[model samples]
Target: MKYPALLPFSELVNQLDQFDSIIDVRSPAEFALDHIPGAINCPVLNDLERIRVGTMYKQVNAFEAKKVGAALVAKNIALHIEEQFLQYPREWKPLIYCWRGGNRSGSMALILAKIGWPVVQLDGGYKAYRQHINTELSQLIGQFQYRVVCGTTGSGKSRLLQALHTQGAQVLDLEKLAEHRGSVLGDLPSTAQPSQKAFESAIWLTLRKFDSSKVVYIESESKKVGNLRVPDHLISCMRNSACISLQLPINLRVALLMQDYAYFISQPNELMKRLHYLTPLHGKEKIRHWQNLSEQDLLHDLVQELIEVHYDPSYLRSIERNFPQLGGMPTIHLNGIAELDFLQLAERLLAE
Candidate 1:
C-alpha cells in the first residue's frame, strides 16, 4: 500500500519559508531561463535527454518514451544524487518539482526518501509556483506606498538607492527590473533580463514585503525602459508620489556614471544612441567627441565634455520642473560625504 506523499502547491509555498532547499528536478535548461527565487537545479533529465524523450513521446508513443526515458532517468538520478544532493543533512527538508510533478520529480523524491532524506515533490511543479507568485504580485501593487526616485541620467540614482537599501530602506531598482540598465550603454556584461511580465511580478513581490502605510523607495523611470514597461498603476503612483531629490555636482555625477558604466568606456559606439537623448541639451560637438572616444584619453575627454554639455543640464532641468522648492522642507544635498546623511534623512521621512 505504498503511495506518493502528495501536497498542494499552496501548502508547498506556505512550507517554502521553512525549507532550506527547493530543488528543481525539471532539467537545467528549464531552471536557468527562470526559476523560483532561490530554487536550485538538480534535474533527473538533462536538456538533451528531455528533448529526446519528448520527441519520442510525441512522434511515437508514451510507451516508447517511457521505455527509453526510464533508463536515462535512472542514470541521471544516480549521477545527480551522488554528485549533489547526498551532502545535505538528514533533517534537510527539500521541495522537489518537475514540469508537472509527474514521474520526473516523483521518482527522484522516492529515491531520496529511501535514503532517509525528507523530500516532497510539488504537486503541480513550477507552473504552480509561477501562478502563486503572480497571485501574490497582483494583490501587492495596489496596496504598497511607492516613493519613486526622480532624477536625470548619471544622477547616481541607483547607487543612492543601494546605499539607502544598506541603511534598511525598502528600495527597488527599476534598472534591475528591465534588465537593461535604462540607458543606451545599459546591457549587462553577461546577463539577460527577464520577460516583461516576470519583471513586473518581481517588482511587485519585492514591494509587498514593505509596510503599505509607509513609503517604498524606487528610482524614477519612464513607461518604457528598453523592452520593459512599468505597470500603469504603479507608474502613476510613482509619478504622483511625493519624492526626495538627491542632487550631486556635475563633476561628481559624470564621475559616478563613468565608474558605474564600465561598458561605455570599453564600448564607446554602444553609447551613441544616448547622445540623441542629450543632443537637445549639449548640441552636436559634445556628442561628436563622445562618438570619437575609443581610448582612455578620448574616454576621459568625453566624460568631461558630457558633464558640461549633457548630464549637468539634464539634472538641472529635472530638478527645476519636478522638485522646485517644495513647501515643507528644502531638498537635501550631501556632497561626497552626504550619502550616509540620507539614511538618517530616510528614517526621519519615514517617521513623518
Candidate 2:
C-alpha cells in the first residue's frame, strides 16, 4: 500500500493540531543539533547504525547497504509500535519527518497507513522547516518594535528583562536563549551553548510568538553571544532601534555581579581560569593581580576592578561603534538592585 500523503511543512505548521504528535525519524545526533519544535525523536537508525550503514553504502553498494539497513529498520519499527504507539487509538494521527522527505519517514508512514491508522510525512521534511524558519525570522524581526536595554556589564539589565517578562511586557531574552551572558567569560560553568542553527531555531520560536504592534524589550548584545552569532538582520535592526540606557552605581553593579557570579566564589580555580582569557588584553601583571584577588577571596575588589578596567571601557566602545541611536537616549538611573527596585523599574519602563 502507498504511504500516507505528503503534507508540506508550511501546511503542517498552520494545521499543527490536526496531528496528535510530530515524530522526527533522524538519527539522535541530528535531532540533538536541532529538530522541529515539539517533535519527539523516533529514530529509524541510531547514530552508530547510521554511520555503519553509510560506510557500507560507500564501500559496497546501495543494494548491499539496504539489505543490512532494512533488517535494522524493521526491528526498530516493531519496537516503536509495541513500546510507543500501542497506546494510541485507531483515530490517532501523527506527522512524521526525516531529512529531506526521505525514506525513513516514508517507511514509518507507510507502515502506519498499512495498519489502517492515518499518518502523513512532511514534504521536504526538516530541511523545509529550517528554510521556512530562515525566511520567516527575517520577516518577523522586521514586524516588531524593539526597545534596547543598554548598560555596561552587571547593570542588572538581564534581571530587569526578567522583571519585565514577569510583568507581562514583551521581552526577547537573548542571553537566556543563547545560554551565555555575551562576554569573554560569558560561558556558564559546566554548560554548553546550543549550536548556531539551534540558537536560530530558538530565536525563531520566540520571535513568532510576539505580537508585531507591541514593543519588544531586548538587551543590547554584541553580534556574537559566546559561540552563537546573532543573525545579521537582527543585529542591524537592534542597533537601529531606540534605546533606554540603564545607569547604576558601581557598588550596586558589583553587588549584582557578586550575586550573579556567586558560583565562582566557591570555585576560585575556575574563576581564575576564566580570567586567564584576559591575559593578552590586560597583560600578565593585571591578570596576576586579578587571579590573586580571586585566590585571596577578595571577590568584591576583583569584580570592581574588572568592571572599571574591562567591561566599562568595552561597553562604551561597543555602544558608540554599533548602536549610534544610543547617543542621546533617555537614561534610567537605578538606585538599588533590590527586588522591589527591579519590579518598579520594569513598571516604569513599560509605562514609558
Candidate 3:
C-alpha cells in the first residue's frame, strides 16, 4: 500500500507560504470557531458520526471502529470530491489535515493521491497546526509595539485609524466588526455584527497580515463591545500594548460625530431606536431630555455627555483594573486640531 509523505506542522506552515489551499477536514462547527488562515471547511465526518466513532473506539477494538468509521469517511469524501475537489487540475497540490493527521486525513490523502492529485497530509494534523498558530500569535502580539488610540466619544478613533491606514500605517478598526462605537450610541451607525468566533477570526487575520516587528494602531475598547465580546487572546494582547490618548474638543468631537454619523441625520427614527440599547445603563428620562432639546447639536452634545458619564468611566475602570499602569504608553496630546490630513497623520505616526 502506497501512502503520501506525511508533513510536519512546521513544514506545512512553511508550505503555506507557497500554497494557496490548506484544508481542515474537521466538522463545520469546529472549523467555524477557529481555523488555519485561508483554510476552507470540507469535513470528512459531521459532528454526530465523529462522536459515535469516538465512543465506539473507546468501547471496542480498532477493527470494529474502522468498520463503521471507514464507511462514513469514504462516503463523505466521495460526495465532497465530486462536488468540491473534482474541479482541480490534475497537477493541483493541496494539503489535507484533521485533528491528529490520523486515520481520517490519511484515508483522504491516500485516496486523493491514488487519483493522481498531489496530496500532503499534515503530520499530527490540525492540533499541531493550532499549537503552532497559538504559540506564534502569543509571541507576535507581545513582541509588537502596538499603538492604542484612546479618546472620548466622537473623538474620531475610527477615522484616525482609517487615516493612518490611508497613510500606509498598520491599523485595526475593532468598531468595523462590532458595528457599534462602544458607547450609548454605539449601535446607531451599523447593522452587521459578526459572531464572537467570526470577530476573533477577523482580528487574527488582520494582525497576521503585518510584520510583528513594527507598530500597529488600534482603538481603545472595553472587553465587551456590542453583542460580541473580545476574545481572551486579543484581550491579552491589548493589555500590554503601548497606548496614546487622542484628545479633541467636545464641540469638535460632536461635529465629527455628526459628520461620521451622517446616516443618523437621514434616519431620525434611529435616534430613538438605538437609544433603547442604553436604557439599562441610562434611564428613559435622560434620553428624553436629549430628545427634548431643539437643536440636533444639543442632542449630540447630550449623547456625548452620556458617553463620558457611562461608557468612558467604565472603559477607564477596566483599563485600571486590567493593568495598573500600561508600560511604555507614551502620551501624544492632540489639543488643537491637526494641521495635516489623515495621510499626514499616518506619515507622522509611521515616522515615530
Candidate 4:
C-alpha cells in the first residue's frame, strides 16, 4: 500500500499475489538452484560479476569491493529498468528479493520507489523463503490423506496417476516433478532433472495447493527418483499411507514397457550403455547377454527379461520392506493397456 515496504517471509507468502511482479536479484547460479516459485530473475550482480566482487572483497578491502560492486549494480539496474520496467505505469507494484535482504534488492526497490511505483522488499529474501519451505514441507505432508499406488515394474502406476488427475483427483506425480521415471533407465532423453532444492520447491508448491480433506493419489517411489531424493518426511508418509495395488497381465506389462521405452529400440547403443550399470548386480555375463539382446533388436525379449530379472525382483523387495500394508491392500487388475481401461479403473477408485 505504501511507496516502499519491507515484508518478512511470513507476510510475503500470503501477499504474493498482490504484486504485479516478483523479482529475484540473486546471481543466476543461485536462482537456478532454487527461488520462489513464480519469481523472475533480474540479477543485479550476475554470475561473473558476483564472483569478481567476492574476490575483491576477500583479497582487497571492503571499501574497494563496495565501490566496484556499487558501479556494477548501478549499471545492471539501469539496463534492467530501461529494458524491462520502462513501460510500467504508476500503479505497477513489484516485490523484490536477493540472497539476503542486502544491497542488491534494496538498490532496486529504492530505484523503483523513487520512480513513484509502489514496491515491496522481501525482508530476509530468498534464504528466508528457503527456510519457510523446509519448515512448511514437514508440517504440510501430514495434513493430506495420501493414496499410494503400488505395482510391479511396467504395471502402469504412473499412467494410473495421470488418469486419476484427469478425473480431477489430487495427484502428486513425483516422477514428473523429478523429470525421471524412477528406474535404472529413467533418465529422460529430452530434458535434465531439476536440482534437489528445485525438486523440493516443486513438491512444496504442489502440496500447498491440495485440499487436506481430499485423497491425494501418488505413486509408490523409493527414497530416490533418479538422482533426486524425495524428502524424508514425505517419503515416510507415503509409505505409511493407504495403498492401491495395480496389477496388469505380464503380456500387457511387456507391451507397455516396450511402448514406453521405444527410444531404446532405435538407439540400441545407448540402451546397451545403460544396461552396463546392472553388471555389478546381475554380473558382467548376464548384463552382456541383455546388451547383446538389445544389439540384435530383440527388444521385447530384452524388456521382458529385464523386468523379470532386474526390476520386478528389486521392486518387490523394496515394496515389501518399505510398505508393510501391501499384503491385504485392494488390488485393481487391468486386462489391457487401452486409455479407456485406465479411465474406468480411475473412476472405480474414485467412486470408492
RMSD of each: 4.0, 1.7, 4.9, 1.2
Please give, for residues 125-240, the per-residue lDDT of candidate 3 as tens digits.
87886677666755555556767777666666777788888777787788886667766556745465666656665676677778877778888777778778876666777767
Clashes of each: 0, 0, 0, 0
lDDT values, one for every candidate: 0.71, 0.89, 0.72, 0.91
Candidate 4 overall Cα lDDT vs. reference?
Answer: 0.91
Can you give the lDDT of residue 67 in candidate 1?
Answer: 92
- Show the colliding residue pairs in model 1: none
Best by TM-score: 4
Decreasing lDDT order of the candidates? 4, 2, 3, 1
> Per-prediction TM-score, please?
0.81, 0.96, 0.74, 0.97
Better of 1 and 2 by lDDT: 2
lDDT of candidate model 1 versus the reference? 0.71
Model 4 clash pairs are: none
For model 4 the local lDDT of residue 194 reads 92
Give the top-scoring candidate (lDDT): 4
Candidate 2, number of clashes: 0
**Which lDDT tens digits does candidate 2 get at residues 240-305?**
999989999999999999898888887888888899999989999999999988888888999999
> Which pairs clash in the backbone of model 2?
none
Q: Rate residue 221 of model 1 by lDDT.
A: 71
